[model samples]
Target: MNDIDAWVWWLVGAAALGIPLVVTAMPEFGMFAVGAVAGAIVAGLGFGAVAQVLVFIVVSVALIAVVRPIAARHSAQRPQLATGVDALRGKQAVVLERVDGSGGRIKLAGEIWSARALDSDRTYEVGQAVDVVEIEGATAIVI
Candidate 1:
């Protein structure tokens, strides 16, 4: 195909790649779409098909190599605020029943929860406050 025709085809391919990126919300496809656009640009500048393909490959691979890990690292970061059962840890609760190592009950986060003292011998009387140390199954380990 002629240079203009090849560039148009490349631009069409870039648009095709972009559609999936939008639909799937996948960053990789977006990166590839960018590479395709780069290839189109090179083709418009009168480069051969081989050179255009090389540009596409290099751009896509470079983007994946450089951006993917950075994206992954950012995504893998721990949230500033805890959530769900994790948020319960380190929170204070009020003893609803006498809390001992074996078993008891506490009013925690607006719900009643089965609880046990972190220290085997420790006990918390009703109305006393305790800190949730961990959760095991349906039970809360507290201190």
Candidate 2:
């Protein structure tokens, strides 16, 4: 096909690749779509079919090699700001009622939470400060 037609086809292929990327939420497809745009640019510049294909392959492979690992590392990392129950761990709370091995109540993060002592033999009296160690279901384990 003519150079203009070839470039148009490459752009169409890029759009096609984007569909699956959006549907599957896979970054690889988006990378390939970008490569297709690179091929379209080469074709619009009047490069031969072989050169266009080579640019597409090189760009796609480079993106996958470099960006993929960075993306994976970012996804594997823990969030800097803890939320929900995780935010409660390691925080000090005031006992609202006497806390023992069986059950009690505490004001944690400004909310009343069901609490129990981390050490079964230990106990906390009202207004005493305790550290939240963990959350099991709706209950907070404290010490």
Candidate 3:
């Protein structure tokens, strides 16, 4: 266009990026903010209103194309609980003390915790093999 200057192209690109960053941070006024940035770029470039519209369109398309794949990967990833017990679920542990049934303790992952027998009659001896069936609070239920 007659009024557009190439030197302001960098400013136009910055406005395009900044609008969405501000929008992500404060979504309520996202549309207004985008419009204002687009308007600034168009006026600064001494261009027509069509340039204002193009700023918004190009910014939105570029944002979606760049962020869509990352978003998809984040959504598909599994979450792991940070607790150590969750890491030991279904893993074998050696009983350090005969499970008292009401509340007993076991040594697992170099840590001691309250434990319960999976079967009522099952007697876990010291150094005997046991599989962690469930973890509840600070206790592990084993078989």
Candidate 4:
């Protein structure tokens, strides 16, 4: 044991930490592995055991403190893409038939869709442009 260098021990610890990182997909373990590498570097440079351990702790904590916030911010963001009916909301549609509260037809997003006026009393004539307000079942509510 005495013949094996301290750097070898640090590298072994880094490999041990990497196992859980791969299995669990946890970034913290990878950070710790990086810290172990830093410790290995310090040991290879002839630093004492305490100095190597201190470097490992400092590197790991710094990586977590700085990287975690950035990672969280990225993960918390919502993609701007709206798909399916959600993409139709607030879009313009042309009345294909007389559209009123009772329902008619409209050309929306290059497709003919069942549509109705948001205001029951409001009517749209054929070829008139209307804004789609929402989707209820297979119908587009417009105004």
The numbered model that scores best in TM-score is 4
Give candidate 4's error at residue 109 in angstroms: 1.3
| Superposition TM-score, candidate 1 onto the true structure | 0.73
lDDT, residue 74, candidate 3: 86
- For model 2, the stretches where C-alpha displacement exceeds 4 angstroms are 1-4
Model 1, total clashes: 0
Clash pairs, model 1 backbone: none
Task: For candidate 3, give the lDDT.
Answer: 0.69
Report RMSD for candidate 1: 3.3
Q: Between the candidate structures 2 and 3, which one is better when assessed by lDDT?
A: 2
Off by over 4 Å in 3: 1-10, 22-70, 80-82
As a TM-score, model 3 comes out at: 0.58
- Stretch of 10 with least lDDT, candidate 2: 1-10
TM-score of each predicted structure versus truth? 0.73, 0.84, 0.58, 0.90
Worst 10 residues of 3 by lDDT: 26-35
Better of 1 and 3 by TM-score: 1
**What is the clash tally of candidate 3?**
0
Whichever of 1 and 2 has more TM-score, that candidate is 2
In candidate 4, position 103 carries an lDDT of: 96
lDDT of 2: 0.96
lDDT of 3 by residue, 53-142 (tens): 677566555655666667778879888564666788988888888884666778888888789987777778888878898998888999
For residues 80-131, what per-residue lDDT tens digits would candidate 2 score against the true structure? 9999899889999999999999999999988999999999999999999999
